[model samples]
Every structure is written in structure tokens, then in C-alpha cells.
Target chain A: MLIPHPLLGPRDAQEFTYLGDAALLARPDGMAEGALGAFIDYVYLRDNPAGVHRELWFHEQGDRSWLVVTRNTVTHEIIDAQLARDVALARKGAVA
Target chain B: MRFSGFRVIKEALTGHKGWQPLWRNPDPKPAYDYVIVGGGGHGLATAYYLANTFRKARIAVLEKGWLGSGNIGRNTTIIRSNYGLPGNQPFYEFSMKLWEGLEQEFNFNAMVSQRGILNLIHTDAQRDAYRRRGNAMLFSGADAELLDRDRVRDMCPWLNFDNARFPIKGGLMQRRAGTARHDGVAWGYARGADRAGVDLIQNCEVTGFRIEEGRIRGVETSRGYIAAAKVGVAVAGSTSRVMEKAGLRLPIESHVLQAFVSEGLKPLIPGVITFGAGHFYVSQSDKGGLVFGGDIDGYNSYAQRGNMPVIEDVIEGGMALMPMIGRARLLRVWGGIMDMSMDGSPIIDRTPVEGLYLNAGWCYGGFKATPASGYSFAHLLATDTPHETARHFRLDRFARGHVIDEKGMGAQPNLH
Candidate 1:
């Protein structure tokens, strides 16, 4: 499998280190109200879908930047890849 | 018909006309007292124990496809109970005990061979870790032996002992650990469950659950709706998808694990051997093919196929461990979907949804835990309480902060 990095061209998947779902970027507030429940859900529960998925991958062998790669879990087709920093900023902007 | 030495002689003499089917393909009934999802090894074994040990009636096992067409038949078929944690050691040891009498009681030929298993030690720190692990195994009433370098050489002199990168300093041996016929295990449990009057329904995909005011009434399947008083789900790989029908998420991510088999050759590997410095384990099948595997593909995927990097990594480990294995041409390789949990252990408990129970999060170790998983699941279904051997496998453990983090990898599912 090849992952198309936003910065570099398409590279072999072996060059990247995988951390699971992109939902992991949304770490819950530790000091907020009902923090324990939110932290438990954030740390444990996962929406592990069988179809389309957006996940985090670290370009450990190259630029060391994390990318949010939109891919299909069933077909293994990479739809798009973007910098994780931009995605996180977009999510935070939407929330605000 | 009962199989014996005399029966074999009679079949040899009489043209073999008395052969019978192993199980019955029964249609789903309108209702059953107990309904189990997933007709793989653990599901069938659970049904068998429910009827035999617990004496439960009107039990049914629903299969999405043909029986044993999942991870049950896809594993490399190594069975051992050399666990180091308190929560997991006794449970697996109980499962290992069940494996001892599995074939005889089930009245099938499962080929339960207990030759031995050796985990090679590459460094002094690894040797210390194995020593503690061996002591843990002995404390759990399981067998474990710490062998020195010469002792390991005496057992398997063909190993790369002298001029290697990470020389084998020692090994941890479990004399009663070995392989069994994976397909035979599934068929044996199916036959036993069939004989006990449990319906084994195949090609019946469960689409949704019929939840009535927080209680499970039954499941809506591809065939039709079937009512049941209690429902237990044992689908590990597809747990997240299946449980979503009931409006629940899990602490799991699915990954692909690959296993390979070399062409049949003369017997070389005595039993199972695991490389301490890398992620490779190997065993020789009865057909003389060397069965081997390495770590998962390290990604979230439901596809039952792996990429080339892991395959190359596993072959490299094998070559580093024993250079002679490089000459064996690879015959076939395949992958299985693994339901990796956050804590790297399994969960067997009642769900928040009343009348619903769950047996999942087994990761890649589900094959070896088939018997005890079934027995404990059966006991829970019958008595509505966790079995003594599996009380730590609670679904609420994560929220309660009582997670069984055996590998100490924290909440990273893929890392575990």
C-alpha cells in the first residue's frame, strides 16, 4: 500500500508509523465537568467503522509530520491526505 | 457412529459405507431460549458447553457464513498458557486444561499434540523477564522451565548458537504446549453442539437486534426475525460492526494479521519457537509444512489481506533466527482480521443492554482461548454471573480504570 503524503509524493506505507483513528486527535479536557466520563470515552471507545475511515499516520522515516489520511478500511484505497495540524485547527475552528 | 480401532478395521473391511455427517444444517426456529451470534470455534464450543455442562436447552448458534470460515481456521495453531499477568494467567491455564481432553470428550480427532514450546532469550534483560514469567506460570499451576544456553543447545542443536547477531543465551520452555488441528477443533465443537440438540444455523447474517425497552427480544437476521430470551455475541473481528446494530461502540480497532506456510518438507521444528528479539513464531504442521507468522500489519483495517512489508519483516526474522529457513520456498500466505482491544486482553461479561452479553476483544489470541471462552460464556448465559476463571474480563473495566493491561502498552490498540 502507498500513502500519498501531502508534502511528499506517494510513498510506501512502510515509511509511515500508524496510530489509529483520527478521533484520537480530539483528546478531552482533563479539568472540565464530567471529565472522567469524557476521558474514558475518549481514551477507550472507538467508532471503528468497516468502510471509509480517516486515520493518523506519522511520517517517521521522512519529514516527521503527522498526516490525516482519508482511506477506506475495506478496500484500502487512500482517498486524500492532509496535514494533521490543519485538520486539528479546522476541527477546533468548527467547535469555536 | 462411534469411531474406534474396531470401527476403522470394519470400515477397511466393509467398503466404508457407514460414514456420517459431522453436524446437521438446521433451519432457524421461531424462538429459542438462548441465541449465540457467530458460529466459529468459540460460539460452537459455548453452545456445546451450555448443553453438556450447564444442561441448557433450546440453544441456537447463528453464523454469518460457513462454520470455521473465520479466524478459527486461519491461525497458525499454537496453544499455550504461559501468561505473566494475574488477570490472564488462570483463565488461559483453564483453557489449556480444557484443550487436554477436548478431542476425547468431543469424540473427534483434533490431533492434540503436546510436544513443547521454546521462547528464545537473546539478552540478559530478556532472560530475567523470562525467569519472572516462568515463575508466574508455575504459580498459576501451569508448567514452565527456564533453560540455559547449553540446555537449549542440547534440545535443538540445529539452532544458530555460535556465530549469530543476537545469540540464543537461553529459552523458556513449556513442555505441555503444542499445536492442534484448527479445523478439527471447529468441526469437533460443531458436532458436539449438534449432538446436544443445539441448532447450528449458517448463512444467517444478523442485521439488527430487537431491543424492547432496554431488553433484547431477539435478532433480525438475513433470513428473518428469530426471538430469543437471551443473546450472546462472540464475533471478535466484526465486533464493532455487529454491536453497532445495538447502538454501542467498543474499545477496539480492527487490524490485519498475516500467517504463512512453506512447502511441505522433512520435519525440522520440534514444536513452537518464538524469537525474543523480533516478532516471529514458528511451528511445523503435521503435513511437514513450516507454519509461521509475525506481528500485525500495524494499521486499522477490516481487509483480511496484508501488505508486503510485514511479510518481508517476518521472513527476515526467520532468516535471522535460523539461516536454513531461507532456503524453503514460500508456498502460501493469508491474513485474518483481528479485534485488537485497548488493553490487549479480552472482555467476557454482560453488556449494559439487558439480556445481552458479549465475548470479544480477544485480539489475535482468540483461537487458543476457544474452549474456556465457550465454557465461561455458557456459564454466564446459564447463571447470569461471570465464571470464576474469567471474572476479571468485565466490560466495565475500562470505565472503572481496572483495565487488564498485560503488555503495558497503555491504550494504544495497534501497539499492543
Candidate 2:
């Protein structure tokens, strides 16, 4: 599988370490009233859809930035790719 | 029907007309005492155990596809009880015992061959690890033998011993562990369940669960709504998706694990053999095709297919293990979605929701654990208590800091 990185050019999937669903980035704070439960969900529960999925892939063999790749699970078609930090910042901005 | 030599002879003499269908194809009933979604090996085996052993009446197994169309038919078909963890060793050993008597109990041929399984040791540290594992297997009432390099060479001299990077040091062999026909297991269990008057409904996909007042009333399937007192989900890879419909999130990830079979050749491999330093295990089928697989695709997806990188990775392992197999032509390659749990162990316990039970997170070990998984899961559904051997497979184990991290890979599913 060729993953198009936001910074690097198209790279092979073997060059990246797969960290599951991109939703893991929005980690819940560990020191809130319901933080334990929220942290459990953040660390464990996943959508794990059969169709399109947004997942985190670390370019361990290339540039070190984590990329959030939107790809179809069934067809393995990459729809888009971007830096995961950017996606996290965008999520925060939208929330703000 | 009882299958025997006489039955075969009678059928042969009577133009082969006396044979009946292995299991009936029935439609969904409006209500049942218990409904099990997913008619794969585990589901079928669970239904069979519930009906036969627990004497449960009005049981139904609903499958979205034809039975055995899922991972039940898409595994390497190796069976062993060589785990090192206390929480895992007993459960798998129980499963190995069930596999021993499955064919006789079900009155069907599952080809439960107990030839042996040899896990090669490549280094001194690896040998020490295998020694500990072999001792653990022995302690769990399973037979194990620590074979030295000479014994391994005596068993199979064709392995790359001299020039390989990971030189063979020794191996841990379990004589009672071997391979079986993957599809035959599903067929046998389905037949057993059907013979016990349990309904086997195919092409019935469960779209949602009918939970009322914090209790599961039944399930809403593609066929229609079916009411049941209890619902047990044994879907292998689709556990998360199916449970999500009931508003529950599982601590599981779906990853694609690819399997390959080589063209039929002269019988080469004596029994199941796994490379110590690499992620390659191979066994020769009755038809002489080498069945093998390695690690998962290292991604979370529900896709039942994999890419070329893992294929190359697996082939490299095979080459490193046995140079003689480098010329073998590949027959076919396929993938199955694995319910990789965070701890790399399975979860077979009751969910937080009332009247709903779960049996999933088998990872690459599901095929070997089919019989015990079903038996223990049936115990849970019938008695509302975890089976004695499966007491450690609790959903809240991770929350309680009791993760059964068998591989010691932390919470990484891919590494496990």
C-alpha cells in the first residue's frame, strides 16, 4: 500500500508503523471527574468501520511526522492524507 | 446420521442416495430462547454445545453468510496448547482436549490430526524461553518435549541449518497438537447443532439489537426482527461493528491477516513447524499444499484482503527458514479479519449490558481455540458465569490492571 504523506512523497506502507484510528489523538485528560472512563474509551474503543476509515500512520522509516490517512477499508483506496497534528489542531479549533 | 464404514458402503451400493444434507437451511423464527449471531465455527460450536451439553431448547444460530464463509475457512488450521501464560494455558489445553473428541462426538470427520507441532528455537535466549514454555505446557496437563538440534535435524534435515542467519538451536514439540480441516470443523458443528433441534439460519445478518429497559430483548436482523430471552454474539472480526449497533464499544481492533497455500507437491512437512526468529509457520495439507501465514497487515481495517508488502514479508520468513521451499509455486493467497485485542488474548465474558454475552478477540489464535471458545462461551450464556478455565477472559480485566498480555508487547495489537 502506497501512503501519500503530507510532507514526503508517496511511500510504502512497510515504511510506516500503523497506529489505529485517528480518533486516538484527541486523548481525554487523565485528571477529570469522568477522565478514567473517557480515557478507557480513548485508548480502547474504536469505530473500526468496514467502509471509509481515518487512521494514524507513523512514518517510522521516513520523516517522523504522524499522518492521518483517510482510506476505504474495503477497497483500500486512499482518499486523502495529512499530518495528524494538523488534524488534531483542526479538531481543537472546531471545538473552540 | 451416524457416519461409519458400513454407512459408506451402504451409500456406495445404493447409488450414494442415502446421504442427507449435513445441516438444514432454515429461515429465522420470530422468537427463540437464545439467539447466536455469526454461524462460523465458534458460533456453530457454541450452539452445538448449548443444545447438546447444556440441553438448551429453542436455540438458533443466525449467520449473515453461508456457514464457514468467514475466517472459519480462512486460517492455517494449526492446533496446539503450548502457551506460557497461566491465564491462557488452561483454556487452550481444554480446547485441545475437545478437538481430540470432536469428530467422535459430532459423528463427522473433521480430520483432527494430532501429528505434532514443532516451534523451532533460533538462539540461546529463545531456547530458554521455549524451555519455560514447554515446562508450562507440561504443567497444564499437555504433553511437551524439548528437542535438541540433533533431534530436530533427525526429524527434518531439510531445514536451513548451516547458512541461515537465525541458526536452529533446538525446538519445542507438542505431539498431541496438529492440523485439521478448517471447513470440516464448521460442517461438523453445524450438523451436531442441527441434529439437536437447534435452528441454523443462514443469510440472516443482524443489523441491530433490540434492547429494552437496559435489557436485550432480541436482535434486528436483515431478515427481520427476532425476539429472544438472551443474545450471544460470536462474530469473529465483526464483533466491534455488531456490538456498536447495541451502543457498546469493544476494546478490539480489526486487522487483516493474510494466509497462503502453495501448489501441491510431494509430502514434505511432517507436521506443523514454526520459525523461531520470524513470523512463519507452515504445515502440509492432506493434498500436500503448504499452508502458512505470518503477522497481520499491522493496520486497523475490516478488509478481508491484504497488500503485497506482508506477502513479501511472509515469503522472506519462509525463505529464511527453509531454502528448499523457495522454488514452490504459490497456489492461492487470502486474508481474514482478526479481532486483535489490546492484550493479544481473547475476551469471553458477559458484557455490561444485561442478557448480552460476547466471545471475541481471538486474534490469529481463533482457529485453534474454536472448540474451547464455544464450550466456555456456551457455559457463560447458559449459567451466566465464566467458565473455570476462561475466568481470566473478562472485559474489565484491562480496567483492573489485569491485562493478560501473553506476548508482553504492552497494549499494541499489531505487535501481539
Candidate 3:
């Protein structure tokens, strides 16, 4: 699969890889609860990729946020991931 | 021929027997036909005009210094007539004409260079304002043209036309506007007046005025007493001090303006360029160096030195206009005190002290107006009537409220 470069062309970044299910797409919305609606819109847009098998994953414990997955065309396997904790927990460690 | 021969023999005898000093005082018959104080450009020019035009040759020009050594030598020489006021337009126009024919009149090469002047407009409002000014110049029979961005680019390709801060939209170009050697202007008039048998007294500082009953009688100089029937003061920066001695207060401020020059470079800036939005103007000297100056040092000080803020502001404006000049190192910077009047225009009129006259208050534009100022001042001194153009610059205008505030900054030292 090929992705068009933002400024240049589709063939500009040839080193790009498409990871299946392992790649988590993260689009940041504002931190307010009202911005969760915008996060839903982001998830909906990513889940509806035009004719591709888009995988979805949920991290309930670690970062306690939603994560989306996609397939890699060059390596035909899972490659990368991301948690939607907007706030990183390791930096803000759980001091119970 | 007999008269000329007799004059020559008398002069020869005077020179031989050291009787020259005795008869040296041309106005030895006591009361002079006319007397002019503050032997600057205007005073000398006034005397020259009195002799040449009115045929009033019994004139004396008293100078504190040796002549051509006052503010006349310390100005950033710029000559232009792009004025916006009705009163100042014709006056500066006359001055421009005089500047055009100065070398011939004085037989002294003032190095008057008609290199043209461009007032770079930055905004639409400024463009409109300069458009009106240019039209005014044209209406008043002067040469002024509005140059668009393309023309500006063609004329000065190095300008930062695309800068975000103050983009250069266009400019007002006056083809006749240029510069003259400042010191040469003073010296030329001095030599001419000296040759015309007018006494150019140097080292004679006017310490006090001998006013008898409410009229000026004579002046008390550092040397001795000199009886002056009619006196004119042409001291620009020190006008207030002289006026005070006459028991009069003026609405003039003594502000110091500084000018800087860059190390010599191959002729890059062919003509004068003044940034309208910014307080900076630049012109190249024949010596391949860039001469530039800006607004005055914002306080009242007689000391001929300026601070760093004005220097930095000027350089910053220059860099914004032409960033390439950032590489050019500054060579020297100097300051000259200006007698800024309530209005930006000069004061050239007879004082209330009967025989006393004035030709001071030339803010920053004195150098360009040297020849015309001198010529008109001479006319006034000889005829005792204000010249047609200089009638607006009366000394009592501030009190009477007929002020010709060209810049609309009344009597404010910082504003003018």
C-alpha cells in the first residue's frame, strides 16, 4: 500500500511500511471531556479506510485508552502500536 | 576708471602703512547700513543678498567662530522640496532653485549633486499621503514622481520588498532633490561675502546686546564693542541663548540630531533613499561611503553627542530596508544640535528690537535650504521687509498663534 506525502508526492517516502493490527493510529484531540466527541470522530475516520482491512485494539489496563490497528502491505504482519492515554503514565507514575 | 584707481591706491596705502586695520572697519562712520549676527549660512546669505540685490554694501556679518564651523559643517547634507504645506512649498522650491544655481552665483563648487531622492512608502496610507505630497510638488512646479513596486524594485533591487514587518509598496521620487557639500556651502558664502567687501568678523563671539531704551544699538562681543545699526541672528541651535539675551523667550527647543557613515564601498546606492515608515535615510558620498542619518537624540542637550538607541534604531531600519547593508560596518557617527522651532519651519524675520533681526530655527532642513535661506535672509536684512516666501516664518508667530507647523508637532522637541 502507498501513502501520499503531505507536501511532496506519493513516491517521495518509499521507506514507509503498513503494519497489520500492530500499528495503532493516534490522533490527539483536546483533553476536555467534550473533546472525546472529536476523538470518536478521529476513530471513525481511521476505521473507515477506503478498501482496507483495518484492525482495532483496546488497552483496558496499561494506559486505559482505545487503540486502532492496521495491516502492513510490505511485511504482511503486525509491526507497531500506540496507547491513547493522552497523558503518559510512566511520566506520571501511579503513587497509590 | 578714476574712481576704481583711487580706491585701489587707497587700499594699497592702507595695506602698506598698516592703516588697513584702521580703515578695516568699513562701517567706521559708526552706525552700519545693516548688521547681521550669527555669521552662519543665513546671515552671510542675507548680507550677500543685501549687497547684491538691494545694493546695500555697508553690511557686517559677526561670527563667534571662524565661519563655516557651526552647525553648517555638521549637517547630513540633503536637499529636497517635497513639502506638504502651502506656505512651505514655494519657499523650499525657491531654495531648490537657488541650490541648482548656487555654484554659479557663489563661484564656489559646493559639490551640489542632483542625485534624486526617493521617499519609500510602506503602507497604503503612507502611499496615499506621499501621493498627495508628490502631487503637491507637481502642482507647485516641482518634479515628483510616484514609483510603483516594480519601479522601486528596478531602481533598488536589493530592497527587501517581501519583508513582513514593513513591506515596501512604492516610493515618492523627486528627481531634482539631492545634496550639497555642507561645509562648502558655508565657506562658499563666506568667501563670496568676504570678497564683496563685507566684513566677515571671526572669533568675535556676541556676548551681549547693547539695547538702549527698547531698541538694539550695538553688540558687545568678546573682543570689544561694535556698533550695529541693524542686526540679524542666524545661529540655528543657539538661537534661544541669543534671544534670551534680548529679553525674549522663544518656543524653540535645542535638540541634537546624529548622523552616521559606513566604511567606503563601491557605489551601490546611486541616489538618496528615505524610508517613510521608518526614521532612516541613506545616500552614497562621492568617496564611495554610505552616509545616513535619522531622528534626533530625543532629549534636550547642547552636547554634540548622541546615545546608542538612535544609532541602533537607524541601523535596524536600514537592515530591514536592505539587509545586504548589514555587512557594511559603520565608520563614524556625529551629532549636530538643531534649534527646532515650535513649527518645523525656520524663523526669519525682524525682532521687536527695532534694528535687531533673526534668521534662526532651521530644524533639520537647514543644509538643503542654505542658498535660498541666505538669499532670502539677505533680502529681508537689506529691505527690512520679509521676503515673499519667508513671511510665514515670523518670530512672533508663536505668540500671535499664526504658527506654520508643517509637521503639526507644535514646539515639541522630540516630535520635530
Candidate 4:
């Protein structure tokens, strides 16, 4: 599969390491109320949907940037690809 | 009717019209004491065990499609209990025992060949790991044999023993573990369950669960709403989607695991063999076809197909292990959706939703664990207690830091 990276051009999926579900970036606080429960859900439970899924793929052999590739799980069609760092920073700014 | 030599002869004499259907294609009833979603091997086996062993009244299995249309029919069919972890060894060994007696107990030819399975060791550390795994197998009352390099050479002399990349050192063999007729297991269990007064409803996809106050009332299916006191789900790869209808998210990801079979040639591979340097396993079928598979697609996907990269990678592993296989013609390639769990093991436990039990996350190992998973899940549904062998396979094990990480790959579903 050819994964289109935000920085680098389209690259083969073999060059990237797959880490499922981009929701992983929204890790809950480890020192808050019901932290254990939230952490458990974060680390364990997954919304493994059959439709569109935002997943984290590290272009380890190429740009070394983690890309949040929004792809359809059933069809394998990539709808969008963006730098995961940019998405995380945007989320932080929104929280601020 | 019981299948026998006399029956076959009599049918032959009577123009071969006396044979009966394997299992009844019954319609779903309005209510049942127990309702199982997914008519795959585990679901059918669960229904059979619930009726025959647990003596549960009013049991029904609802299948989204025809039986054995899922991973039950799409696997390399290798069965072994050579696990190293305390939580997994005994459980898989229990499954091995059930596999041994499945054909006789269910009165069907599942082709439970006990040719044995060998996991090759390429490194000194791998040898130590195999030694520990073999010891764990022995501790679980399962057969295990640690074979030296010469012994492995004796078993399969054609293997690439002199390969510089993966030198043959030793292997761990389980004489009782081997392949079976994958689809035959499903048919046998379905027939057994049907004969025992359990309903097998096909084409009845479960759309959602009917929850009343905290307990599960029944399931909303493609056919219609069917009421039941308890509902068990064993939809191998569709575990996540099916459970989501009840607002439950599982610690499971769906990944495509591809299997390949070569064109029929002369008898080659004697038994199941696995490469130690990479993730690839192979066994020759009775049809003289080499049945083999390797790692998943390395991504979360509900698609029952894989990319070409994994296919090329698997063939590379095969060629590295046995250069002789390069001449063989690739005949068929198929993929099965694997319900990969975080710990690389399975989860057969009660969910937070009362009366809604789960038997999922079998990953690549689900096909081999068919019988035991059914039996254990039946025990759970009948008595509301975890089976002794599978007590460690709890849904909360990940949260409690009790993950059954046999490969030590740590939380990555794709890697597992």
C-alpha cells in the first residue's frame, strides 16, 4: 500500500510502522480522579470501527514523522494524512 | 442418521438418496434460554457443549452467514499447545485434548491428524526460549520434545540447514499437535449441536443487543428480534463491531491474516513446521498442497483481504526456510480477519453488561482453540464462572497488569 505522507511524498507502507488508532494521542491524565479506570480504557478498549479510522503510522525509514492517516478499515482508502505532531499541537491549543 | 460403512453401502445400493443433511437450517425462535451469536466453530461447539455437557435448555445459535464462512475455514489449521506463559499453556493444552477427542465425541471425520508441529530455533536465546516453552508444555501435561539440529535434519532433511541467515540449531516439537480439516470441525460441531436439540439458525445476523435495566434480554438480528435470557458472542473478527451495538468497546483490533496454498504436488512437508527467524508456518495437506501462513497485515482492518507486501514477506520467509518450495506453483491465497487482542491472547469473560458474555480475541490462534473455547464459554454461560483452565483470560486482565503476553510483544495488537 502506498501511504501519502504530509512531508515526504507517497511512500510504501513497508517504510512505516503501524500503531493503531490515533485516539492514542489523547491519553488521559494519570493522576486525576478515576485515573486508573481512564488509563485502563485508554490502554485497552478500542473503537475498532469498520469505517473511517484515524491511525498513527511512523515513517521510520523515511521522514521519521508520525502521520495520522485517516483511512477506511474496510476499503483501505486513505481520506487524509497529516503530521501527528501538528494534530497534537492543535488539540493542545484547543484545550488551552 | 449415523454415518457408517453400512450406511454408505446401503445408500450406494439404494441409489445414494438416503443421506441426510448435516445440520438443520432452522428458523430462529421467539425466545430461547441461551442465544449464541456467530455460527462459526466456537459458536456451534458452544451450543453442542451447552446441550450435551451443561444440559442447558432451549439453546440456539444465530449465524450471520453459512457456517465455517469465517476464520474457521480460512486458517493454516495447525494446532499446538506449546505455550510458555502460565495463563496460556494449560488453556491451549486443554484445547489440544479436546481436539484429540473431537472427532469421536462429535461422531464426524474432522481429520484430526496428529503428525506433530515443530517450531525451529535459530539462535541460542531462541533455544532457551523453546526449552522453557517445552518445559511449560510438559508441566501442563502436554507432550513436548526438544530436538537437536541433527534430529530436525532427520525429520526434514530438505530444510535449508546451511542457510547463513538462519542456521538450523534445534526445535521444539509437540507430537500430539498437528492440523485438522478446518471446515469439517465446524460441520461436525453443527451436526452435533443439531442432533442434541439445539437450534442452528443461519443468515440471522445479530444487529444489536436488547438490554433491559442491566441484563441482556436478547438480540436484534437481521431476521428479527429474538428474546433470550443470556447471549454469548463468538464472532471471531467482527467482535468489535458486534459488541459496539451494546455500547461496549473491546480491547481487540481486527487485522487481516493471509493464508496460502500451493498447487498439488508430490508429498513434501511431513508435518507442521515453523520458521524461527520470521513469522511463517507451513504444513502439507492430504491433498498434497502446502498450506501455510505468516504474520498479519500489520494494521487494523476489518477487510478479509491483505496487501501484497505481507504476501511477499511471507513467501520470503518460506523461501529462506525451504529453498525447495521455490519451484512449487502458488494456487490460492486467502485472508481471514483476526481479532487481535492487546495481550496476544483471547478473552472469554463476562462483560460489564449483565448476561452478555463474550468469547472473542482469538487472533491467529482462534481456529485451533475452537473446541476448548466453546467448552469453556459454555461452562461460563451455564455456571457463570470462568473455566478452571481459562480463568486467567479475563476482560480486565489488561487493566490489572495480568496480560498473557506469550510473545512479550507488549500491547501492540498487530505485532502480537
Which model scores highest in DockQ? Answer: 1
Best by lDDT: 1
Q: Any idea what lDDT model 3 has?
A: 0.72
Best-to-worst order by DockQ is 1, 4, 2, 3
lDDT of each residue in B1-416, candidate 3, tens digit only: 11244666886978745222211333223556677887777777777777766677777887787676778888778999999887788889999998898888876778899999999988998899899988889888899999999999999999999889789898999999988888778767766776677887777788899999888888888777878778788888888777778876665656679999999999898689998567889999989889998888654446677767678888988998889998899999998878776677788888778888888778888887777788788777777787898788887666566877777865454576
Per-residue error for A41 in candidate 1, Å, reads: 0.7
What candidate 3 gets wrong by more than 4 Å, as runs, is A1-96, B1-31
| Residue B216 in model 4: lDDT | 96
The CAPRI classification for model 4 reads as high
Model 1 off-target regions past 4 Å? B162-165
Clashes of each: 0, 0, 9, 0
Tens digit of per-residue lDDT, candidate 2, span B306-395: 999999989999998888889999999999999999899999998878999999999889999999999999999999998999999999
What are the fnat scores of the candidates, in the order listed? 0.96, 0.73, 0.00, 0.92
Report the Cα lDDT for residue B208, model 2.
92
Question: Residue-wise lDDT of candidate 4 within B1-416, one digit each (tens)?
Answer: 98777888999999999888988788888999999999998999999999999998799999988987898888888888888999998999999999999888989999999999999999899899889889988999999999999999999999998889789898999999999999999999999999999999988899989998989999999999999999999998999999999998889999999999999989878899999477788999999999988899989888889999999999999999998899999999998899999999999999998999999999899988898999999999999999999999999899889999988898889988
RMSD in angstroms, all models?
0.9, 1.2, 23.6, 1.0
Model 1 residue pairs with clashes: none
lDDT of 4 by residue, A1-96 (tens): 788887777899899999989999999998899999998899888999999999999999887999999999999888889999999999999999
Query: Local error of candidate 4 at B339, Å?
Result: 0.8
lDDT for each candidate structure: 0.93, 0.91, 0.72, 0.92
What TM-score would each prediction reach against the true structure?
Answer: 0.99, 0.98, 0.75, 0.99
Q: How high is the DockQ of candidate 4?
A: 0.88
TM-score per candidate for chain A alone: 0.95, 0.92, 0.25, 0.97
lDDT: worst 10-residue window of model 2 chain A: A39-48
* Chain A vs. native, model 4, TM-score: 0.97
